[model samples]
Target: MTRILFLFIDGVGLGPDSPENPLSTLDLPSFRALAGRQPWTSRSETIDRPDHVFRPIDATLGLEGLPQSGTGQATLLTGENAARIHGRHFGPYPPTTVRPTVQDKSVFAQLAPLIGTDRLAFANAYPERFFQHVEARGRWTVTTLAARSAGVRLRREADVRDGIAIPADLTGRTWQRLFDADAEPISEAEAARRLVALLDDHTFVLHEYYLTDKAGHSQDPARAASVLESLDRLFAGVLEAAGPDDVLLITSDHGNIEDLGTKSHTRHPVPLVAWGAGADAFSSCRSLLDVTPTIVELLTR
Candidate 1:
């Protein structure tokens, strides 16, 4: 059986390859190898090699002012035009109007019945504070809502200590500093290896990283560069660890870190980089709405 590891990076888009973009200024060899280009931007064209596929896909869902995460992530996970359904692109969290769609139509919800909940995993671990937030307010991100609907176990700090989960930052340092997590910090490459190792037990594993978006919003070039560099290392490790039977899918919901000119999301297209088994099937994806359906088809076919 083939396995899929979906890496959902938030708030990244193709921008101009200039000083405003750390992607343009950095030396990320792994990204270059997988994407077949440097500083993937508007000028960058699609690369369809025999072993990999890379291209920019639309994040703006037509009726958009600026694409927001709530609708964008919902669409990415559910294969539905969430913004259109809700009559606008809405935020950092899913709106009440879009919650039902995320709960029912998300890739996890759709796949659980076909592949069994046991075969699906959301690889990001949560802190105790997050669980308390869930209990107190009941607000959830699109990804968590989807996973919850499917009865997927939301990983926790113990999962990280057990080597079964990866932190959102691709290293435990942030968790240690912020939450006083007991897990020792590991290198980004080691984090990638841990994520890839999940394939042994799961048919589909998803890891979400939002610090890119946070850094982008900060308009701090150094912060953006640091996050991108960590991702570069993680990507290299995944490529090294993933076997022929595993497919790696990388994409984002909206654009932010690509251009530091503003503290807002851009209308720029986000990159979709796919490699390993059944990667070609994803070549048809042109927007956030197409991602979940492509994965469903690939996994179910």
Candidate 2:
């Protein structure tokens, strides 16, 4: 079976390769080597390598406003024109009207029957407080809703400690700071190993990292670059650890971190970086809606 490791990075886009863009300022050797290019920017055209591909895909979905996570993520997960269905770009969370589609047709939900729920896994570890918030407010992110809809068990801190899951921050530093727990930070290499290991028991594994978006919102160039640094290492590590049958897909909801010029999400196109087995299947992806379907096809075919 072909194993898929999907990394959903929020608020990243292909901006101008300038001082303000971390992809330009930093040396992402792994990213560069895998994609066969450096400083992926607005000027970057499609790169079709023998083993991988790197390109920008439209995140706007032909909408009229800055792309927002709600509709953007829904569109990515469900492979549907969520923005049009909702009549507008909708947030940090999906609108009530759009939640049903995410729950019923997300990549996880769609793949459940074909791959079996037992073979799908969401690798990001959630803290106890997250569950408390969901219990109190009945709110959930698109990823979480999708996972639950497919009966995929959401990983927890214990899973992180057990070497079976990864933290949203890539490292456990944020978890320690937020929860005041006695935990040591793990290196990006170790996190990569843990994530890759999960494929041993499942056919598909997904992990979400959102701090890049938060850093973009902060408008702090240094902070944005720092997070990107961690991600660069994480991606490199995953590529190194993956087996012959493992395919890796890295993408984002919309553009934010790539350009710190504005605190809001940009109208820029986000990158679609694919590597290893089945990587070529995504070379033709033109928009967020194409992601889930291509991934489903990769594994099913």
Candidate 3:
């Protein structure tokens, strides 16, 4: 069987203003369609389908203060309580001591050998400038470090230029350009469709969407709604195209986008939604650290 397709949405959570929450706004016909007539909420809920059921997994690690992306992601992908280990929540960037842990224990590093290179893929293609910047500065995030350590090819411009990979937006332009051109409006459904199309060849594909955090920082309800609408459209498309055997796992590192009262991460639990073969494996998870181990268990079993 093909490995799971992991979809990581940065800084998302379940919250009120039901209509305003991006998860709620998403007209995910595919998800709802698969989930049948069951109730869906930004908070944790389970949906049963003919083939399989998708359940929401939590992302909070149970520490005080706001969750930081670096530690939160480290915990999510490594199954380690990174914030607690470091004494407090770290940053958008990982601390020096945490580097080894991220490199050695992250999902990519732990699972790559079991799954093989061709079977594993990270879908976010990088621009040429990003490569150049990283080369000069030598700074890296937990995700990048994990992928690099695992020998997973960090997607590059060629992948995008050749159409092998699509931008986070379908138009094949930089996200900045998409924002500039109100003309480039592709709904969340469309975005998900494109992602599904892109996943045809890989056993494991990971895609990251970071717009929620940006919307939270801006604290504009209109902008937040717009972001949510876009994601809803994207997921709708993915659900429509998803294969019966394919698994879609939607998760996050922290809780920044759910609450707009402050431009900071929340201690509230982040939602983890899973569909397909190994969806049940997530039932064993309770914190961020359990995610990577759960995925590994599912795929390796």
Candidate 4:
């Protein structure tokens, strides 16, 4: 069977929120539907389903202070404790010291050979401007670095222009303005439909969602709520359009939006929800480092 889709949401966590906490204002129906009814004692949970197992994972790499995106994401995609190696948590970019590890050890790099060319793909399409920025700085985010190193083709403007990839605003909202005019909001449902269309074309498709982290940094309840709602709508659409062979895995690195008490990351654990084949294997994952290995195992099996 095809490995299906993998989604990464940045800087999300699990924690308590008071009235003053902006996170309490957001309506996360899909998240709440999965997590609210259950009691989360640790950073992870395994909800048993007939055909699949749903698991929530911890994103923090067992460190003190808030987990930063740089280290957290590196660990999530590479299965290495980037924060511990750097001596402390880092920022939005992977430290130069970890470049070799990220280049050689990430999921994309390790899994590409097994999946074959065009089978493993990164679905996020970058505009010409973003490519120019990366070219000038010679810098890459953990996701971009991992995918590029693994030999996965980075989605480009041509992909968007030719209807090969979908933008983050698969629902056709405000975010679409960032892209060129040829882009259209296909609605969340249609976006999922298109994603399923690509599943047959590729074995492993990875997508990144950073809006939750952005909403948290802004510390606006209205915006955060809207983000959650849009995400929930997206999830709902994906679920509806998902095929029997399609597996959906959602995870994050560190905590930020789950508790809005501060503008920094939280000590709380991030959630890892899975559906489809091999979900049971994820129930045993304990930290961010375990993610890449788990995905590799699932795909290879």
Candidate 5:
């Protein structure tokens, strides 16, 4: 079976060759191996490789202002120009205007007919507090809203306890320290195994890693370095465990942490990396709006 492990590393972009950029600061072996070199900075960026595909899609979708998580993520997941629809870049959370688009066009929604609802997995687990917040505030991230709209079960605390789901962080550090949840911190290898395990039951698996975006907003060099290193370690483990049939696809909505010069998102192009039998199927995508369509075509074909 051709299963996909969609690793959505938030707030990353093809950054420039600057000291503040993690690409210039950290040693990322997994990324290096995939690209056959280090991640390209704007001073030295490339596109269209056999194993890796780096495309600079317009996050803004021709709307003005810096790209944001709400619109950018909605566009990435649903193939809709969310920012343009809203007439402005809108947030950490998606705006109400584009909520319908996300619900309708997310990959989860589009692939439901072909893959079946039972076989698509939103592999990230939420803490009790998160559930409580959503219940009270009626708020949801673009990814969560997309999955829920498609009738997919969002992984919960029990999923984490059963070693079947990953926390927002690859390791369960925050879960162990911040919550009363019995989950303990695991090694990167364990995390990778849990992610790969989803392939047994799922045709499409989505795992969100928001620390990259968080690190970008934090503007702390040390934190940025730490997050990048940890992410690369997890990527290495997943790469080692993934089977030949498992297509590993990594991408982001917008660039932020890649260049810590500011505390906001950058207009730089996002990274779309896919490796497996149908890796080249994604090469034609020119905008963020093309991602879900490309994946839907490949998975259904």
Candidate 6:
């Protein structure tokens, strides 16, 4: 079986090969080597190697203004033109108009039947506050709602405590810092090991890191650098752990943190980076809308 580990790194976009871009500032050897010793540039979009493929896909969806997370992530997860359906780019949460698409066509819902729920997982864990917020406002991000509609069990604090799921930071450091618990930070190698073990049981596993988007909006250079630095370690561990059959798909919803110069999202093309056997599976994609369908097709096949 072709096991896939889908990595959704939020708020990343292709920018100029300049110091202003945090990605350019990140001294990540593993990621840099995957980029063929280049920055995340338009030139990198042309890159195609056996084990790595770096392609830039449009995030704007041909609409106006900066692409927002609600529509962008919805489009990526459902293969729907969410921006068009909402008549414009929507924000932090999905608008009422496009919520149905999120619930119905999300990759989680689409693949549940093909691969069985037992063989799939959404690897991010939610905190108690998130559940409380949902109860208070009855809203959620596109990914969470989609998984719920598909009957995919969303991981919780217990899952995190037991090491079955990871927090949004890719480590439990935030949990330790925030809750003042005795939790030690999860190492990148351990994260990679846990993810690989999940792949052993699941045909597909999805882990979302949304802090990139928050850091982009905060426009804090120090914060953005910290987030990128941590992710580089986790990514390096993932690269070291995953093997030939373990297809790795790393992508983003829209562009944000890449350019801290702007407090708003940019009209940049996000990268669709793939490794292992799955690299070729996304060769035809050029936009966020192409991601979910391609992933679903690969998993179902």
Candidate 5 Cα outliers beyond 4 Å, as residue runs = 43-52
| lDDT of candidates 1 onward, in order | 0.90, 0.89, 0.69, 0.73, 0.84, 0.84
- For lDDT, the strongest prediction is 1
Q: Is candidate 1 or candidate 3 better by lDDT?
A: 1
Model 4, stretches more than 4 Å misplaced?
A: 20-27, 36-46, 169-176
Off by over 4 Å in 6: 180-183
Tens digits of per-residue lDDT, candidate 2, 1-301, equal 7889999999999999877778767887876775576676887768876468898999999989999999999999999988999999998899998999999999999899998999999999888889999979978999999998889999888888788888899899998988874556799999999989999999999999999999999989889878988998998889889999998989999999877778999989999988886688998899999999999998898
Candidate 4 residues 1-301, lDDT tens each? 7366887888777666555344444555555555534432243345766445555566656667778888888888888889888888887999998878899999888887787767887877776777799979988998888888877888875676576676755553543576544555566666666666678788778888888898888777777777777777777777777777778878888777766657777777777777775666677777788878988887888
RMSD of 4: 2.6
Which residue segments of model 1 deviate by more than 4 Å?
Answer: none
Looking at model 4, residue 124 earns an lDDT score of: 78
Off by over 4 Å in 3: 17-44, 47-58, 169-194, 197-199
Arrange candidates, best TM-score first: 1, 2, 5, 6, 4, 3
Task: Assess candidate 1 and give its lDDT.
Answer: 0.90
Residue-level lDDT tens digits of model 1 in 236-277: 999999998899999999989988989989999999999997
Per-prediction TM-score, please? 0.98, 0.97, 0.85, 0.90, 0.96, 0.95
Encode model 3's per-residue lDDT on 149-170: one tens digit a residue: 7888887656655545545544
- Candidate 1 vs candidate 3: which has greater TM-score? 1
| Superior by lDDT: candidate 1 or candidate 2 | 1
Score residue 181 of candidate 1 by CA lDDT. 90
Residue 16 of candidate 1: its Cα lDDT?
A: 85
lDDT of 3 at 86: 86
